[model samples]
Target: MGTLLSGRARAHPRELARFVRLFTVVRREIEYALRPTGDLLHRLALETEFSDFAFLQTVDTRFRQGEPLSDAWDAAVLALQTEKLLKTEEIALIQAFCSAFGSTDPAGQSANCAYFIDRLSELQKGAAEAAGKKSRLYLALGVLGGVFAVLILL
Candidate 1:
C-alpha cells in the first residue's frame, strides 16, 4: 500500500502540472477570451494536454450559468476525485486558483493565473524530485520487509 501510494504521490505532481498549464493558458487568454467563458473553456480544453477534459466542459456550463469561476472550479472538484492522482493539497491549490477568473481586470486575473502556474510548477517539481529519490527506496524496503516476514514465519 505504501509503495502504491508513493508511486501515485509522484504522479500526482504531474497532475498538478496539468492544472498549472490550464491556469497558464487561461492567464494568456484573459485579454481576448475572458468573457463568454464557454469559448475560453472550449479553446483551453482543446489546447491543453490535460486528460480531464470533461472538467473544462463542466466549467464552461457553470460559467454559462453565471456562476463565479471559483465556484465553478469548486463544483468541478468532484471531477478531480475521479482522477485519483491528486493529493488534497493539489486540490486545494486548484481550488484556490479557481479564483483567478474572479477579477474583471484582465491584468489582475492574468497575474493571478501566473501565480498559480508558478506555484503549481514548483509543487510538481518537488513531487517529481521526491518520486525520483524515494520510489526505489520504498520498493526495496517493501521487498526486504516481505523477505523478513517470510523468514520469521519459517
Candidate 2:
C-alpha cells in the first residue's frame, strides 16, 4: 500500500511503527522471560505474518548457528538492500531497527527500539508530504510533454 502510492520503496509511518512495536514487545518479552535468543526467534517464526518474517527467520538461523547477534542483524539488513520497494531512507531505518536487536542488554535494546519508533513516525509524515507534491509534479510534466509532442506533429 505504501510503496506503490509513494512511488518508491518507502514504508508508511503506520506500517513501520507496527513493526517497531513488535520489536519493542519482543524486547520486553526477552527481558522478562530471560529466554535464549534462539528460542525467542523460533517463537517469532511461528507468528509468520509479519512483513519481515524472512528476516526473522534469518536471525533465528544465525542465532542457532552461534553467529553474533550483530552479524545476524547485518545479514537481515543486507537482504533488504536489493529490494526496489524500499527507499534509501527506509533501508536506513530498517538498519537502525535491526541494530536494536543486536544489543545483549534487554533494557538497552528496548530503548533503541523506542527511539527509532519516534524517528520513523516523523519520517512517515515527511514521506506523505513528498509523495503528494511529487505525484502532482510528475503528472503535470507528463501532460505537458504529451501536448507538446502532439503540437509538433501537427
Candidate 3:
C-alpha cells in the first residue's frame, strides 16, 4: 500500500514542477559563486574599501562603463594567496585587499568561504527536507482518501 501510494505521489505534476524550480535556483547560485575570475577587481574598486592593489587599479581602467561591485574582497584574497608563484609585493597587495575589504587577513577569507559554503549546504539540505515533507504529506493524503473510500463502500 505504501509503495503504491508513493508511486502515485511521485506522479503529481505540481510536485515535479516545484522540484525543478528548486534545482534550477540552486544550480545558478552555485555556479555564480564558484566561477573563476569573476569581477573581483571591479568590485574592489567600486566598494573602494580595498582599492590599494595596483593590478586592481589597472583592471578598473578597462571598465569605462559603470558597473556594480558584485565580488567580495574575501574571495579575491583567497584566489591570490592560492597562487604559488606570487611575488612579495603581490602578496602584500593581496594582504592589503584583504585588510581593506575583509574583516581579517587571509585566514578570514578561508573562514568566510567555509561559512558561506556551509550556509549553502544548509540551504540545500533545508530544501530537500521541505520536499521530503511535502512528498510525505501528499502520500498520506492519498492513502487516507483511499482508506476512506473503502470504508464508505463497506
- Cand. 1 TM to true fold: 0.70
**Worst lDDT 10-window in candidate 3:** 14-23
Q: After superposition, how far is residue 34 of candidate 2 from its true place, in Å?
A: 3.5
lDDT of 2 by residue, 122-141 (tens): 77677667666766666677
lDDT of 1 by residue, 1-154 (tens): 5598567657766676667778777776786666654567756666546445666767767877998766777788878877767778777877776554654578788788788888889888898888877777777878888899999999
Please give the clash total of every predicted structure, in order: 0, 3, 0
In candidate 3, stretches whose alpha carbon ends up further than 4 angstroms from where it belongs are 1-66, 71-107, 143-154
**94 Cα displacement, candidate 3 (Å):** 24
Q: Write down the lDDT of every candidate, Cα atoms only.
A: 0.73, 0.65, 0.44
Reference-based lDDT, residue 102, model 1: 54
> What's the best-to-worst order under lDDT?
1, 2, 3
lDDT of 1: 0.73
Q: How many times do residue backbones clash in model 2?
A: 3
Model 3 agreement with the true structure over 38-91: per-residue lDDT tens digits: 344345455543355433554354433443222343343344556433434434
What would you estimate as the lDDT of candidate 2? 0.65
